[model samples]
Target: MSSTSIIKVQVDDTQFKSFLDLYQEYQEHLESAPDDWKKVGDAIGDAGADMEDFADASKASKEFLLIAATQSEIISREIRKASAANNALLESLTKNVTAQKSFADQAERSEKHMKELKKGASEFAHEIFGLGSFLMRLGALGGSLAGLGGLLSGIGLKDLASSAVDTQRSARGLGMTPGQLTAFNQDFGTRYLDPGVLGSISSAQSSFSGRMWLARAAGENMGQVAGEDPGQLAANLAIRAHNWWVNTPASMRTAEVLQSTGFTQSGFNLNLMKQLGNTPLAELQRAAAQYGSDQGRFNVSDRNTDAWYGFLRQIKDAGNFIETHLTNKLSDLAGPLQHFADAVGKDVTVLIDQIFTPANLNALEDGINGFTKYLGSSQFQQDMKDFAGLVAAVAGAMRKAARFLGIDTSPSSSTNPASIPVNPGLDPDEVQRETRGQVRGYGGVSFADKALGYTRHKLNMPSDPRAVLAEMDAKNGLPAGTLEAMWAKESSEGKNLVGPVLRNGDQAIGDLQFTGAAWKDWGKGGDRWNFMDEAKSGGAYMGFLSKRYQGDIAKALAAYDWGRNVDKTIAQNGANWQKGLPAESMDYIKIAKILNSQKQNVRVTVQNSTAARVAVQIMRPQPNEHFYRLSVSV
Candidate 1:
């Protein structure tokens, strides 16, 4: 109970050892996204379904209008040609009313059918007036209707003046002023996405479908469910109604909104659904939800359908397309991860259960002693010999990933740096400068540590450029993480394989984006297609630049971007060399500050003088490496 004590720790849990254990547990696998994400997918899907229905109805109404107009014109032409008495005869034939009169009746029927079609279509469109974001997505195909963009299409929309009048009349029926409808339509998507609307909107029941669902949920007559209501049905209300329709644990998956909540948007999946033309909506949704897992769409009979469930099924169908690259990505890693585990002599088996360090190395332990004792052992020698092929395998995977991003990979062949064809384009004077020593390839025990560190720290990359980046920085005597952060800013850590490939300027590729000319000179010995090799070549070049600039990071980076032209830039700006650099080069220097923080190494307390020791490590122990311990205390 001393108040002056330096540290006082409170235990929240009796068995808690370290916070890292909790972090490792939670970080083990990807978990389900929050309910808010699911709701977003629901909003998109449900609104899309409404728009799809409206699109179908609008299309039908216009077709009827076009045909009716064509019929009217034909009748008028015939009437002009007819004699007065024959016109009466023609009317008698059409009805036994004349043929012209009968045709006129058909036109009237068509007009009536057009209005009916527009009426139903208006209801769906009006309901979806609350989902403007989904409408914008549809507008990618045809412009948004809110701004009369759909009304202005040069494509097949024949009755603009009449449709506008009908829309105005429908707005009046919904008790919304023209101005209010525009304002309401503009903000519907936002309202649907908000959870707070649930309490207030539940009391304001509106549309027939909304009324029907409310009636069913409360066991009341559909006629009586209309409480002072708004005509628009929000996404949340539809979801609530679906839950009410199917509330049981065993059957909730059969609910419409539950089926609809997934990533595939309507526009993205249109062609997919068209492929299975006339496939049942239930079957399509069921197949799509099964891609990642069976999130069930149509297991129950059609009798389970709620009144508004038809639109909900279409919403779920949109989500069924499920465009994702995660499965392929995971499959790509299975081989590399397994091979690496095997290469490490099985001591690295089962992550989270063991502290994984690369074994069979020449590294000294216990500290830094008996180094290279393992190198003499025959087993350890085989590991070293096998390493070249392992490196090739990992490099091959990196190459594959690079190719996936459409990078024209640089070739890896010539081993000797001297054989690299000289680039006459490089500043000949700078090329001749002292490099201090030959550039080092990451081989030996140090490489093993770095590669394993990448797997432990960064996840899933077959090889991380950061490790290579660190070595590249060191070659120039630049700080560790300096190049890594710059590359992160440059090419998003090599996710962007090539830049300016399409531009009619200097083509660039890989993380550092060494131009074809630059690669020819500085990168001749390395594979521009391979990230690690690209880093080494790029780092060496930057090192050359660093020496020329007297270790001024800004000067070195500016020169890297501007090339030989940076000298002219420096000459122009005089003392303010930074202002002379391009906007991008100045932006590149900002990450140096970012990487500076990364280079601020966190010093951990290490016990050096031994208080305890062990005879064996109990790992896949090498013949001479029997002196492994769990921990040595000082």
Candidate 2:
């Protein structure tokens, strides 16, 4: 649909205003009449009482007073009855007025919608007429031709005409005009072609073109038929006939007319509108005015007037009965309800006041300030600062411990730092100097020396070479400190020889022979275990020996032989030793030979012990102590 075709209907401001005025007047009449009625009734009752009092006086006053009292009572009763009737009439009038106003508003909306629909329909008809005219003219122009060449020319023209008609027809059907169709065709091109048009033109180069010509002729003829206007004479005759039909009275009811009328009656009762009209606001006002002006006499004797007054009093009393009872009950309920309402109102008012007032906002600000003040207190600040400091201290200690353990302790510097080489080239002179200094005399210093030295310095111990070495041995799990402690304890017990003998014979012998030999071999040969080699292999050898010598005397002997051979080799070949060996050559030839020999010897000894009751003796001689021997035959 075109954007312009979308109708936006506006309400009639004047009609709305008039309806609003009527509504306001109706509401005012409804609200004010009850109080006015009550006031009038009260006045009438007061006047009647005054007249009655006068009527009860002496004979000279009796005649005038009785008439006055009678008239007063009559008038009071009439006035009260009139007020009540007027109140009822006013209430009904208000309701009718509201309904009428709503009806008027709805009628206005319906009228606006009707106008929009009529406008749309008129535009649609106009577009259809324009499209039909264009198609009819195009068809007539294209159809006047003959011969093969003429037929081809005619086919082309007819195809063009048919396409134009189809395009126009589609636009018109879709509620668009030729101008809009043209614009759409230009904007969207072949996209807007009717599917039938496209399919017809698709194979039209064959005999389908002839069929298309026939179809086009038929469509064009249909368009012409649709476009034709009826003769003026016929239109005039139709109008005259419609006027005559409308003017003529029905002699007898036709079936269609009867059905239509019955349908109308069923849908809406027309007589109801007429009846409502009779009791409309204007008619009711006229009736009320006439009733007031007539002043028709009701039975006016003194007794009758008294009776009427009594009747009115009874009616008034009846009306007031519920009100009186309600008033008493409501009076009882009023205090509590009013108190509750007051409390609710006060609470609502306080909430509103807090929402709108700056003072409450200031109180909120004060609360926030109090919280901030608490946060900023010396104790809180100090606690936070201490916590931060403690965290820093813990982090620093952790970093120091990691460094002491030779862990990678570098802090992350940046999220995307430049990638640096892990082993950047060192200065050749500095490397050579480090290498030469690192390779000391016959026994090369280890990487553990610096680590051990660091530990000793941190412990605030004397920088003795042996102390550092002892610490290194202990750190490497050699139990040197335990041996020293045991030796000291034995000396204190005057058992010096025992500790020495145990140390030299077994534990110390094992260390000096196995571990010491391995260290010597590592230093001399420049093998992986060689301390002179940058990649020290002694640690690796120890790990291997630890596994091999897991839990047997054979292992201890092997370790001792390994150490002895390593020490002997180091003593034989000085600093320049391992120069002739290939990179992949083994370092344990001598140790292996010694272990093999020891294994064979031990096996023979065990065999001999089993064959003969060989006695094994352990002898120890001490100064100022007897030599003792302990022997066991196995």
**C-alpha lDDT of residue 413 in model 2:** 34
lDDT of 2 by residue, 151-186 (tens): 644435434444455555554453333334443333
Stretches of candidate 2 off by over 4 Å are 1-616, 619-630
Candidate 2 lDDT for residue 545 = 44
Off by over 4 Å in 1: 1-464, 502-506, 595-634
lDDT, model 1: 0.50
Query: What's the CA RMSD of model 2 in angstroms?
Result: 64.1
TM-score: which candidate is best? 1
TM-scores, in order shown? 0.24, 0.12
Q: Give residue 233's error in model 1 in angstroms.
A: 71
Structural RMSD, model 1: 56.1
